[model samples]
Target: MIGVSHIVVDWGTSSFRLWALDRAGAVLAERRSAQGLAASAAEGFETVLETHLAALAIPEGVPVMMCGMVGSRAGWVEAAYVDTPAGLDRLTEKAALVPSARRPVRILPGIAQRGAQGSDVMRGEETQLLPLIREGFAGLACLPGTHSKWVRVEEGKVSGFATFMTGELFHLLRSASIVAPAVDGAATVDPRSEAFARGVGDGLAAPDMLGSELFRLRAAWLLEGAGPDAALARLSGLLLGAEFAGAARFGGRGPVALIASGPAAALYRAALAQAGVATVTTHDAEDCVRAGLHAAAVSAFRLERMSA
Candidate 1:
């Protein structure tokens, strides 16, 4: 077996993913857990990280590169932000070193956008964009998640971007709002459902009416006998459609390249299609992050030979 040479971590607010990579950047082993920044902050970042490394039997001195909330002010070490119109190369150049670690540890800095539209920032998503930058991809790219991001890239630089609270809103509505009972115990929405498509149309046509439309879901359940599945589908469609509508206003002109995986990807594709927006490309979020981390590792550790 090839000896582990570097460790890549994508640590977020609620989840953690670790990959042990050889010099060639191929994964030798992986570890994933719910021990995110919040948990790690309480348990001690060093302790959480060392325990994971010990379980993987990774040798000491293997350099570690991390991205995401792990670099936020609330994380192990604050990595600061690189302003927008930023290039991927700048991310590598500005990586912050974590002091007092047994092994070399560096955290990649995130990108920030400040303008009349207000300020916005992202942590781990910057690493995921390295592959797009390397490929010279220009246009709109959407990263769908808890807080979805719509980024506009031009000539290998992040020109501008926006964030939507779609996923978080969905969680709140489904679990804590008046619409909760309608979707309680319901299975995930089927992306192809007609109810979902209708909801998308409703959202695009009247995004300003989202609050009223949400109440309509409950009305449909209480008055018109709507099924829980249909209500769930409608809710999902409404939220995603509103997000796409907002993105359309700021995404400039071009086809969207969606970076996502699994069910979220399918749902986004369906929503976009229903909204009449063509998706020119789709990249797996996991794959992009891995490739991005590999790229960052190469740039950060230039002196190290990257061949097994």
Candidate 2:
């Protein structure tokens, strides 16, 4: 509480997370909510942020560093994208300043990839990748979420990456598609289920059969009497397996480094194993983002004065 020098925010499209941290990068206080960028845009970014800060009794003039959709065009302000082959230094160098804030506020820039494969971009995930980049990590990394990203990092620079809509598609299919009825309960998947393993096998064997396999979930439930839980688990495996199959096309030969948290992390780990893709390491999503934000804050605000 005494040395708290900054507040870090990870403002995603549908969620908001804030951390009050000491100069040592240790969390002093925290806040989270459903008031993400979209919702904050409606209620007002400053108002929403202030309300949360007020509730936590955060002092005025504390430097604030934010990442994610908060920097998007639709959020508080546009923090432009840093092109591929970027590193931590580039990200820190290009951080955008928010205009007219009572306190000093900076939004970390997202990384963009553009070329013959069209264009792709990520906002908050770049922050999560900072620690790895700084450590000179070189490997394939997977960050699973609503839009999962498979990245190629070589010697501390992000060379290329691809996004998969597996999580989004799973949400759509379970909530709005014909498989909705068969995907009852809490929309959860059991990684240990045989049905899940079978689904992964099916997906890895024939990724192109995604459409037909999705239909089979409904058919299996309607005709073969498969339970809703099994159906849900199977659907999760199938989608995740399909994502792995697609990522394999990129020719990443080594074990993958999985960056995720909670349920998504468990699910991805299981699916990757089922698909025969070994995981060399795992990093907690929360820790990675916080570490990245802290690293950025150190460079941006010169926190080394206190931390040292």
List model 1 lDDT by residue over 29-116, tens digit each.
9999999888899999989898999999987877889999999999988998999898998999999999978888899999999987
Give the Cα lDDT of each candidate: 0.88, 0.88
Give the alpha carbon lDDT tens digit for every residue of 170-236 in model 2: 9999999999988777447878889888888888788999999999988988998788998998899
Cα RMSD of all models vs. native, in order, equals 1.6, 1.6
Worst 10 residues of 2 by lDDT: 299-308
In candidate 1, list every pair of residues with a backbone clash. Answer: none
Model 1 Cα displacement at 163 (Å)?
A: 0.1
Error of 2 at 242 (Å): 0.6
